[model samples]
Target: MEASKIRLTVPEGIDPSRVLGAGDGVLRALENLVRAHVVARGDSVAVSGDPDEVELVARFFEHAFREADAGRTLSADDVSRCLAVLRDGEHDASSLRDDVLLSYRGRVIRPKTLGQKRYVDAIRSSTITFGLGPAGTGKTYLAMALAVAALKRHEVGRLILTRPVVEAGENLGFLPGTLEEKIDPYMRPLYDALFDMMDRERTDELMERGVIEIAPLAYMRGRTLSDAFVVLDEAQNTTPEQMKMFLTRLGFNSKFVITGDLSQRDLVGRRGGLADVEKILGRVDDVAFSHLERADVVRHALVGRIVEAYDAYDDVREQRSRDRKESR
Candidate 1:
């Protein structure tokens, strides 16, 4: 059989090391995965193997070079991710990785999947966005990134992060110290993601000056949120009335992002606000909804499988219930 070969030339400004990786480990991974005899030197790479494998190796470097050309460094995992995305052939690897929502320190936050890209785009174009998805799909995290980005760009006057502090009915004031202390635990996740993007000193400064507000959903009642980017996280625990009040609080020059897992709602004997608003505002002007699926889970790879498993179980349970009711 004749040998099939392909040579890739790394762009001028992009270092070959960035595309081919600096370590022998990742270099070997590329060879093993692509099943090609890879010899990388200077600005050029040579892949000689089966025609199919040679093409795979060529595509891998093509994406890696593009990522490097865009000034985004690719780690080994990123290289692997790029290869997988290219192999899937459903999405453009550069497009998914290039629209950076925020960059902090050395970390670049952006959509990892096609669904996430659509969700972020909806958030950008709509006045109100509902991100309904399973856990670990980057719904809340992306919203936070965009909210911080907007605040940095002076597109909004402030940022508001809130969630329902469910205690049967969110009347948690009966538990402990001031309302701040009472709700502090429930607010920890918001604070954690916020501080990740900004230094603790600066985050505290914003909190102290009221430039960034982190409060319970109950606290947001009867207030006008103007010129702000408001994120309501874990909104599935909110009641219909609470959702109404929260949406009505939107003032001029403001954007609202509500994120929740509808299947995980904990609103005892009451309909979840995220689910309720979906039916009402789905067709309303300037309001949008993005439904993310298991494929969008950006946590561990196992998380996507786990979400699929639970979704399957839920379907079976619902079907069984319907069967039993029909037999009566």
Candidate 2:
């Protein structure tokens, strides 16, 4: 057997050190993963070893260079993810890396998973998109990103972020603070996402000018939202009537995103608004439902396993109940 060698010229304007990673850590990681001797020189990377290993290394960096060309700096996590995708052959690196949506303060926001990519696409193409999934799937976060992008592009006049506050487990009037203070906790996630995409000063300015509205879902009643981007988060907490009211509030030239986790609904003793509306309008034109499963979870790796475990438990519990009924 003979050693095969391949070299890749790093693209100009992309720091070769970044492509290879800080202190050549990324090169070492790639070398260890692909069983190859990786070397990086001025504006070029060379791979030598087993022919197959050399080929894998070449293909892996090829994808990495493509990502760099697309305005993405390679991170250690990205290196691992791209390597896995290349090995598994389920999806290409370009699908995971291209299309920079928003970049703020050195943070590049784009879909980190395939489901998120579909959810983003649904928001772009449909008038209403339901981001149905478990926690950590970037459902609400991605919707907020898209809303911010639309606002910046002037595709919409304003941004509306609302969520049902049922999860508080406390009555609103009894809370010690004012209405804004009372609802702040429930709306914090939306605010966090917004601030992540925009500076605090600008976010506050937009909110003060009424260009961005963050309110409890109750406030959406009797108002038509025109030329705005609206995101209804934690939608599983809304009653059917509330959902209907919110849906009807969608005026012309607006985009609406509804995100929820069906398993985590806090609504008491009645069907959740998200589930009800999904059944009723699921077949309607220009409305999309992008369902994300445990595999789409982008949080700490354990979260996906946790979601899968809970789903399996629920399945067994349901089967046991059915068996008990059959015995009767």
Candidate 3:
């Protein structure tokens, strides 16, 4: 079959170079990926390729330009996300607009990819949501945004952010000044996310008043968390007992978002509680498990490729193990 060709017209309001990226990097990626020849000619994109590939290129432009039109500056990461959404078979980019989860101080927090959108939606509708994915997929950040948004809306009385401090799991007294001081390094990410969404004064006030409590997961035992939005970050380091204790702490009118990168689990001798709970809660009601992939990574463009390489390496190792097992 002969390769088809199409000339994509670019509107005057949008710059072709912006969509194409600096040095035509995105263009080169498209050409190499779809095996299509892409070129930017005076306010339009000229491409020759297979019919489906041509259509895909068109959809990518549609998604990218839609985001660009929605007041977001275009980037190579945006281009990659657009292509990811197209590959995921979701064509509409309109929902990516006007859907500000939270807006404060000119910083708008919203899902940048379809996978993130699903994860965010799951957080909204579920009692317990597990955002299991690689790093930089916005799992923890988006969960934090939702928690803050819910707090602002008065849907929850308070917000509780906690993470498993694997380094000082139960031996915090041996470390330093105070309990808070000892775990400060491990819990800084959660505090950083809170400060990003809220002002330091308000956050500090809430902490002083105990409305917004940032504590290590070990402190959660024997407590019923009620009327709050609770987040368990870095849950993959949790043991089964700790996970049960954490889940059982869910009190009335509370929501939980457990975000972790299972691949980065730090448990050396025991299975990660997140891995266990996923299998146990696969069929439970009001529970959601959203998985993000390498393509869902929204950090540096190389991050997604790095995730892909690691995934491929893991696949090879697993296959080799299976082959050895068969021989034995």
Candidate 4:
């Protein structure tokens, strides 16, 4: 069988650097992904391999260049997503690439996966959004970015970040520290996300002025938060009563994002608040629930595979449990 070849011309006035990425990293990634030998010359990229592989490779570059032409810098994550689309034989994803949610300092924050795009859209169109997924799915991070953007745009009067300190479990009384000190560890992720979106001095200033508030979930009790962008992280640790209290606290002109991984809940012998809330409020209007799966894990490449492995294990265990129950 003879090898097939396709050459993609670099459009004038479009930076090849953006399409190729730094040091040809993007090209290399594509080469590793597709069964093709890719070469970049003066003003074109050549893909040579099997006829079928060549066609897919061509489409991949074509999709990526469209994004580059539209002034979006393509990263490894973008390349990975494009590869996934190609393998899945999905149609064009140019719309996903074009939807820039937020830009901070020189970095643009956009959804890298289809699930994440839906998650961000839900946050924008709904008064309450639930991002339920495993780690590295951008559940909390994207919610934080959206919340910060809303506050920066003056769409809301304040930003409130809170999470339950359930890692201590029932032995919380033994923790030797004041209330603030005891909860600081659980709230560090929220603080880190805030600092990522705002400078330390500005974040501190906002905290001092009450424009940005970071506190434990207990701090949210009995307070009606109005005109605020509120995010309750690690909601899986909250009890059903706590979840109801938090949900009822949403006031006029306010948006709430409740994010948690039900699989990672630490609420000993009790159902996760997020799970209960999902069952109760799923059909309610103005509330959206977006779920990200293993494919949405945007951390290291192995993280997605790790999630899949654990999911497989859980399925087997569940089957055994069901079989034993039936036998009884």
What TM-score, over all chains together, does every model reach? Answer: 0.79, 0.79, 0.87, 0.84
Worst 10-residue lDDT window for candidate 2 reads 95-104
TM-score of 4: 0.84
Please tell me which model should have the higher TM-score, number 3 or number 4.
Answer: 3
lDDT of 1 at 57: 75
Please list all clashing residue pairs in model 1, or write none if there are none. Answer: none
Model 1 TM-score, 2 decimals: 0.79
Q: Which candidate should be chosen as best, given TM-score against the real structure?
A: 3
Q: What's the true lDDT of residue 260 in model 4?
A: 90
lDDT for position 31 in model 3: 71
Question: In candidate 3, how many Å is residue 86 off?
Answer: 1.8
Clashing pairs in 2: none
- When sorted by TM-score, best at the front, the candidate numbers are 3, 4, 1, 2
Whichever of 2 and 3 has more lDDT, that candidate is 2
* Model 1 CA lDDT for position 89: 79
Question: What lDDT would candidate 3 get against the real structure?
Answer: 0.83
Clash pairs, model 3 backbone? none
- Candidate 2 segments whose C-alpha is farther than 4 A from its true place: 1-61, 68-92, 98-103
lDDT of each: 0.84, 0.84, 0.83, 0.85
Q: What range of 10 consecutive residues in model 1 has the weakest lDDT sum? A: 97-106
| 206-226 per-residue lDDT for model 3 (tens digits) | 889988999999999889999
Write candidate 1's Cα lDDT for 1-328 as tens digits. 6779887788888777777666745577776667679987888788898887788777777777777786755665465556666777777777676454555665878887777878988999999999999999999999999999898889998999999988755567567798779879899999999988887898899989999999999899879999999999998998888889999999999999999998887777877777667678878999999999886788987887888999999999999999999999
